[model samples]
Target: MKFKITHITTYLFDSEVFLEPHYLRFRPSQTSYVNVSELALTILPQPAGHKMVQDEDNNSVDFCWFEGMTSQLTIKAESVLETKPYNPFNFLIYPQNFNTLPFQYNVLQKKLLFSALEVVPISKVLSDYALSILQRSNFNTIPYLTNLTKQLHDDFSVEYRADGAPFIPDETFQLKRGSCRDLSWMLINVLRQQGLAARFVSGYYYFDMVKPAYELHAWVDVYLPGIGWFGLDPSHGILTGNTHFPIASSAHYEHTMPVSGGIRGSASSKLNTELIIEKL
Candidate 1:
C-alpha cells in the first residue's frame, strides 16, 4: 500500500513567549518493509537553527532551536511512502527455551535490553491479569502474547485522549479503558513483569477507510531472542505489519512523544493537531 500523510500541530499561547529547543519525531522510521519517497517539514516562526539527528533508539529526530518571542508556533510534516505486505508472524523464535513463558534472554541480549527489561511496580490485579493470559496460552510465549493482546482489546474500551502521558498500568487496568498510549504502556509493564523486554512504539496506523481523521498511534515492541524486535498492537489485537509505520520507539513512552520541549514564559497555551492519511 502507498500512502501520503500530512500532520499539523499548532500551539497558541495567551502571550508571546520564548520558544525553547524542541525535538520533532515526524520522519517515519524507514525499514525494509517501508520505503519513503518524499518528505517535507515546515515550521512557522522558523527556527534559528535546526538539524536532523538520530535519537538514542536510532529514530530520526529534527532538533530545532528558536529565537525571539512568538504567540503561536506551527509545525507541518508531509510524506509519501510505500509499504510492502508481509506476514507479521513470519519469523521463528530461536532457542527452544525462549518459546515458553517467563522468557529469559541470553547474557549479551539482557545487557543490551537493560532498559526495556526494567520492571515497573505493578499491582496484584495487573499481575494476576497477565498470569491468567499466560495460563490460557499454556505457558507458551507466542500464545501468551497473542492471548494477552486479544483479551486486552476485547475487555477494554478505547478512549480518545488528545494529550498527557499514559496512565500507569494499574490505573489502566482498574479503569478498563484508556487511549492507545495508555494501553501500550500498560502492555509494556505487563510484559516486563513476565521477564520479557518490551518497548513503547509511536507511529501511524493506516485504516482502510475513506476520508477518516487520524492521529499518532502507539503500540508495543517485544524483543524476542532469535526474532529480534517485533511489533504488537494491543489496541487492535493484531500483530503490526506494513501498515504500521513506526516513527519513534523507546524503553519509555515519554521519549517517543512527537514533540518535546519547554517554554521560557508562564503563558498558558492551547494545542491543536490534525492528521490526514490518504491511500494513493
Candidate 2:
C-alpha cells in the first residue's frame, strides 16, 4: 500500500519568544516492512539552520535551529511511502532454551538487550493482574502476550490525549483509562515484569475504516530470540503489520516525541496539531 501523509503542528505563544533548537522525528523510518520514497519538512519563520541526524536507536531526526523571535511557530511535514504486509508469525520460535511460562534470557542476551530490559518496578496489584492473564493463557508466551493485548483493548477506556505527557504505567493501570501511549507503556511494563524485553513505538496508524481517518499511534514491541521484534497494539488489539509507519522507537516515550524543543522566553503557549493520511 502507498500513502500520502501530511502533519502540521502550530504553537501560539502569549508573548514573543526566541525559539531554540528543535528535534523533529517526523520522517518515516526505513525498515524491511516499509520504504520512504519522498519526504518534505517546512518550518515557518524559516529556521536558521537544519540538518538530519540519526539517533542511537537509528531513528532519523531533523535538528533545526531558529534565529528570530516570534509569537507563533508552525511546522509542516509531508511524506509518501510504500509499505509491505508483514506476517506477525513469520519468524521461527526463539532457538534458545524455552521451557517455562516466563522466558529467561541468558547472560549474553541480557547484556545485549539491557536498555529494552530496563523497567521500572511494578506494583503488586499490577503484577497480579498480569499474572492472572498469564495463567489464563496457560503460561504460553505468544498467546499470553496477544491475549494481554486483547484484554487491554476490551477492558480499558481509551481517551484521546493529544497533549501532555503520558501517564506512568501504574497510574494508567490503576485508572484503567489513558491515551494510546499510556496503554502502550502499561503493556511494556507488565511484559517487563514477566521478564520480557519490550520497547515503545511511535508512528502513524492508517485506519481507513475509522471516522478520523488516520492519526499518530503508540504501541509496544517485544523481543523474541529467533523472532526478533514483534509489535503489538493494545489500543487496537492487533499485531502491527502494514499501514504502521514508525517514525521512532525507544525505551522511553519522551524520547520518541515527534517534536520537542524549548523557548528562551517564559510565556504561556497553546499547541495544535493536524494530521491527514490517505491511500494513494
Candidate 3:
C-alpha cells in the first residue's frame, strides 16, 4: 500500500523573536517495512540556514535556524511512501531457555541493548500493576507482552493532549487516563522493570475508520534476544504493522518531538497543527 501524508504546524508568537536551531524529524525513517519515495518540507520566514543530520538512531532530522525576527512560523512536510504488509509473529528462533521470565541476555546483547534497558524508578502502584499482568499471563513470553499491551488499552481511558511531556508511568497508572505517549511510556517502564529492553517510538498511524486524517502517534519497540526489536502499540493494543510509519525513535520521548527548538524572545506562543493521510 502507498500512503501520501501531509503535516502542517504553525506557531504564532506575541512578538517577533529569534529562533535557535530547530530540529525536525518529520521525515519518516526508512525501514524494511516502509520506503519513502518522496519527501519535502516547507518553512516560512525562510530559514537562514538548515541542514539534515542523522541522530544516534539514524533517524533523519533537519536542523534549522532563522535569520530575522518573526512573530509567526509555519512548516509543512509531505511525503509519499510504500509500505509492505507486516506479520508481527514473523520472528527469529529463540535461544535455548530464553522464552520465559528472568530473560537472559549475553554480555554482548546487554551492552547493545543498554539504552533500551535503562531502568527508571516507578511508584509501587505501577510496579504492582505491572506485576499483576505478568502473573496473569503466567510469565509466558509472547503472551505476556501481548496481554500486557491489550490490557493497558482496555483498562485506561485516553485523554488526548497535543502538547507537553507524557505523564510519568506512575501518574498514568493512578489516573487511569493518558495520551498515547503517556501510555507508551508507562508500558516501556513496565517492561524495563522486568529486565526487558524497550524504547519510545513516534510516528503516524493511518486509520481507515476515521476520515483521511493523520496525527503524531507514540508506541514502543521491545528488544528480544531472538527477534531483535519489534514494535507494539499499547494505546491501540496491537503490534505495529504496515500502517504504522515511524519517523523518530529514541530512548527518551523528548528527543522525538516533530519540532523542537529554543527561542530568543520572551514572546508567548500559540501552536496549531493539521495532518492528513490518504491512500495513493
Candidate 4:
C-alpha cells in the first residue's frame, strides 16, 4: 500500500518571544517493511539554522534553531511512502526457553535492554490485572501479550487528548479510559512488570478510509531475542503491521514527542494541529 500524509502544527503566542532550538521527529522512519520515497519539512519564520540528524534511538530528527522573535511558529511535514504487507506474527521467539511468560532475558540481551526493562512501581490492582491475563493465556508469552492488548482495548474507552503527558498506569487502570499515549505507557509498565523489555513508540497509523483526519499514534514495542523489537498496539488491540509508520521510539515517552523545545519569554501559547492521511 502507498500513502500520502501531511501534518501541520502551529503555535500562537500572545506576544513575540525568542524561539528556542527545537527537535522535530516528523520524518517517517524507513524500515525493512516501509519505504520512504519522498519527504519535505517546512517551517515558518524561516529558521536560521537547520540540520537533519539521527538521535540516540535511531529516529530521524530535524534540528532547527531560530534567531528572531516571533509571535507564532508553524511546522508542516509531507511524505509519500509505500508499505509491504506481511504477517505480524511471522517470526518465532528465540531461545525456546524464553517462549513462556515470566522468563528473563540472557545476560547480553538484558544489558542492552536495561532501560526498556526498568520497571516502575505499579499498584497491586495493575499487577493483578496483568497476572489475570497471564493466567488466562496459560503463561504463554505470545498469548499473554495478545490477551493483554485485547483486554485493554475492550475494557477501556479511548479519549482524544491532543496534548498532555500520559497519565500514570494505575490512574489509567482505575479510570478505565485514556488517550493512546496513556494506554501505551500503561502497557509499557505492564510489560515491564512481567520482566519484558518494552518501550514507547510514536508514529502515524493509517486506517483504510477516505482522506480521514489523523493524529500521531502511540504504541508499545517489546524486545524479543530472536525477532528483535516487535510492536503491539493496545489502542487497537492488534499487532502493528505495515500501516504503522514509526517516527520515534524510546524507553520514556517524553523523549518520543513529535516536537520538543521551549521559548525564551513567558508568553502564553495556543497550539493547533491538522493531519491528513490519504491512501494512494
The C-alpha RMSD of each candidate to the native structure, in angstroms, is 1.1, 1.5, 1.4, 1.1
When summed lDDT is taken over every stretch of 10 residues in candidate 4, the lowest stretch is 206-215
The estimated TM-scores of all candidates read 0.97, 0.95, 0.96, 0.98
Worst 10 residues of 3 by lDDT: 206-215
97-139: candidate 2 lDDT, tens digit per residue: 5424766888998998888898788889989988999999988
How far residue 44's Cα lies from its native spot in candidate 2, in Å, is 1.2
- lDDT of model 1, residue 265: 95
> 3 or 4, which is superior by TM-score?
4
lDDT of the candidates, in the order given: 0.92, 0.87, 0.88, 0.92
Tens-digit lDDT track of model 3 for 106-188: 89988888888889899887888878888888877788889889999999997779999998888999899999999999999
Candidate 3: give the clashing pairs. Answer: none
- Stretches of candidate 3 off by over 4 Å are none
Q: What TM-score number comes out for model 1?
A: 0.97
